[model samples]
Structure formats: C-alpha cells, structure tokens
Target: MAIVDKSTLLVLGPAAWILLAALLVLAAAVWRLALEGSPAQMLVAGLRALVQLAAVALVIAFLANRGAWAFAFVGLMFVVAVWTSGHRVAPSGRWWMAAVPLAAGVVPVAALMFAAGVLPFNALAIIAVVGQQIGGAMSTVTLGGRRVRDELAVRRGEVEAAVALGFQWPAARLMVGRPVAGEAVLPSIDQTRTAGLVTLPGAFVGMILGGATPLDAGLIQLLVLISLLLVNSTAAAATLWLACRGAWVREPA
Candidate 1:
C-alpha cells in the first residue's frame, strides 16, 4: 500500500469533513439536552483545535530544520500545557501553580530518556516524545487538581477535624484529598493494561500503517504507555500536593 499518495489525501479530506459534521450534530444534541452554552463551547473548542493544529503544522515544518528552534518549540509547548492545565483546574488565582506538577512529571523522564539515548537529540524525535509526555502530564494534573479540590470542598469538615487533631492544615487537606486525586491516573493504568486486547492505540496503528513490523510497533507503543504511566503518576501526585497546599482553594460562597 502506498503511504503518501493522492488516495490517502482523498480519504483524509472526506474524513475531516465528516468529523466536522458529526461534531456539529453532537454539539446541537448536547445544547438541546444539557446546558444551552455547551454548543458554543463545543464549536469554539473544535475551531480552536483546527486552528491550533494548522499553526503547529506550519511551525513544525519550519522548526524541523533547526535544532535550537525545535527545543524552543518544545519549551513553548510546555508553557502552553502548563497554562492549559492550570486554567482547567483553577481557572482563577494561582492557576500557575499547575506548572509544578507538569514540570515535575515531564522533566525527569525527558532527562532520563536523553541520558539513556532512548531519545535521539533530533527535532522530530524530541517533539514527538516530549509533546506526548507533556500532554499526558497536563491531563493528569488537571484531573487530579480538580478532583482534589472537589473532594476537599465536600470533605471540608473532615479536613478541619484532622486539623483539630493537630495535623497541619496541609496534612489535613492531603488526607482528605489523596484518595480521589489518585483516581486521575487510573485511566492510564487501564489503557496500558488493555492496549492490544481492547484497543489498538494510535502510535501502534500509525506505525503499522507506515509499514513497521508488528513487533516494532508494539515495542514503541509499550514504551509510550510506560512513559505515560510515569508521567501521569508524578503529575497527579504533584497536583494533589498543590491542591492540598491551598493553591487554588475556593472561597466560601
């Protein structure tokens, strides 16, 4: 099968249009059944994703030739990931605290990959690996942060009681928030366990489609999944810590 040809482009063209139409229909259904504001939100998210991806494609084309520019691009991606996760979790003051968890998860693994020569010092390779790791960390951080905040709010009395029993405020909050915060990483765990059985992940499928052997694709996919586990676990733990430390505690209404 020819990988890069007119037929591939033809298929992608229709697929994109069909996806857009489906999104519109789904947005309409959501608006009619749920919040009236959701349709606009959905449309906006879709449009923004399209624009962002186009822009990234252009940027990647330019950056692929320059090692320094590629590193800078990755840095920009990290910053955006931090801002996005922070906004999703906190949406108000001190949302920047999200940077801690994102960095905590991404930096160590990235460093180790470089040191082990698993990640080549090349533009495309660095972008692909680091981008996925950053994205995974961002998702886990946001999930853990939001869950901890909600848990803290619901279990405020328990936290107070712990404080009353001489636990520090942070410790009290951690005690209340830890259980649910860990739930953020459960998806990663489940996906890793069920990868080839229940679902073929994109990385594996893409590699196979690009003519890689099944064994090679499977190995790469395993590496990606294991890397995600490390990233999400660290990020979730950090997010919980930040939440317990009152990084974005809401004021009583």
Candidate 2:
C-alpha cells in the first residue's frame, strides 16, 4: 500500500471530540502567529500527523497478535525516524550517514536489554523499548543537528579565525560545537534530574496502570531513564563527529 492512504472521518463519537480539539489547537497556533499569516500548511500537517498516528495505532492493534508484525513495525519506525532526522540535520545525500547514529545508539541498548533479560523479547516489550529508542534518537538528532547549524551561522567568523590560527576543522569547530552539543543534552538532563519531582514519566505511570507495584514502577522508570541517557549520549557523540567532519557543513550566505 502507498505510505499515505485517503481516509476520512465523518466527525462522530470520540473522533468528533478529537477533531474539535485539533481544530482548537490549529486556531491557537494560528492566532499565536497572527492570523495575518496563513496556517493552511500547519493545519494540513497536523491533520496528516493525526491520521498517521491513527493508522499506526490500528497497525499496532493488529501487531499485538503477531510478533513478527510488531518487529516489522518497529523496523519501519526506525527507518522513518532516520529519514526524519536526516532531513532535519542535512538535506543532502550525506545525510544517509545518519544511519550510523540512528542505529548505533539504539541497537546496542536494545541488544543489551534483550541479552540481559532486562527486557523481554515479546511484542509489548519490543514496542516499548523501540519507542523509547526512537524518541531518544529523535531528541539527540534534533538537538545536535540544529545546534551545530545555528552555531555555525552565528559564529562562522570564529570558526574561520580558529582555522587561520592553525586549528584543524574539528578543533576549529570545537569552540562552538562542544558548547552547542553540550546544550543539546540539557533537556534530557533536566528530565532526568526532575523525573518524579517535576513530572511522572510514562514508564512509571504505565507500570502503575498495568498493576505493577510502585516499587516495580520506580525500578522500570529508573531503567528507562538510564537507557535514554545512553541512547542520547551515543547519538550526540556520533552527530558531533559527523559535524566535525563537515558532513553538515555550512553554506556561504
């Protein structure tokens, strides 16, 4: 089947409520931006995202009964994730190299979880871990990529000055790169530091809802926190290396 299918909702039941909520959000975003500007694209994108999610939910509902389907779905998700990260990072052929960070960061953690039996190799467990991996990678990629690009734009002269002073590309970029990449980690760090105090993470609430004890929920949340750190760390490191190599080099203004 084509990636996107033509589908419609007649706006009834819970879907009607959801559509109302979505329209509200669209109106809010447009109003925030000043309705002098068109939000047609934004509305379309929002609708697309909602439909895509609905389709995925339907697919997962079926996958719950088939382990292979779940695995395949996870694989497809990773592929789409890499495509998205690459597009945002470097809209060029070289972006394909993002496969390294995308896979390297997520796969090992997943492998370790399965090997150590920390995560069962079942449909639900795989889905959960894979979801976490994709989310972590997405965060890292967006942070690392956007920061590097923005820093380069703001500090191109600094980069050139360093290069003129005999610094190699990597060393020259380090002045802006290190700090930006470091900042990229702030969200994850803040989330970790304030996990329970500021926000109850999904894992904890999910475990509780699933009838697990609070102790079990706490342990699972802790494990998830650690796992996300590893995944993001690896992705950021890989992204930094790619940036240093000028894989995402800035174009002249």
Best candidate (score: TM-score): 1
TM-score, cand. 2 vs. native: 0.83
Q: Please, what is the whole-model Cα lDDT of each candidate in the order they appear?
A: 0.86, 0.79
lDDT digits (tens) for residues 1-253 of candidate 1: 3234542323455666787879777986788677756666677777888899999999888878676677899999999998998898888767788889999999999998899888887887788889999999998988888888888989999999999999999999988898898899999999999999999898888788788999999998998899999999999998988887887755567
For each candidate, what TM-score against the reference? 0.90, 0.83
Candidate 2 weakest ten by summed lDDT: 1-10
- In model 1, residue pairs whose N, Cα or C atoms come closer than 3 Å (at least 3 residues apart or on different chains), thus clashing, are none
Off by over 4 Å in 2: 1-38, 249-253
Taking the tens digit of each residue's C-alpha lDDT, what string does model 2 give over 118-181?
A: 9876677788777888778877887787788778769989999999989997888877787778
lDDT of 1: 0.86
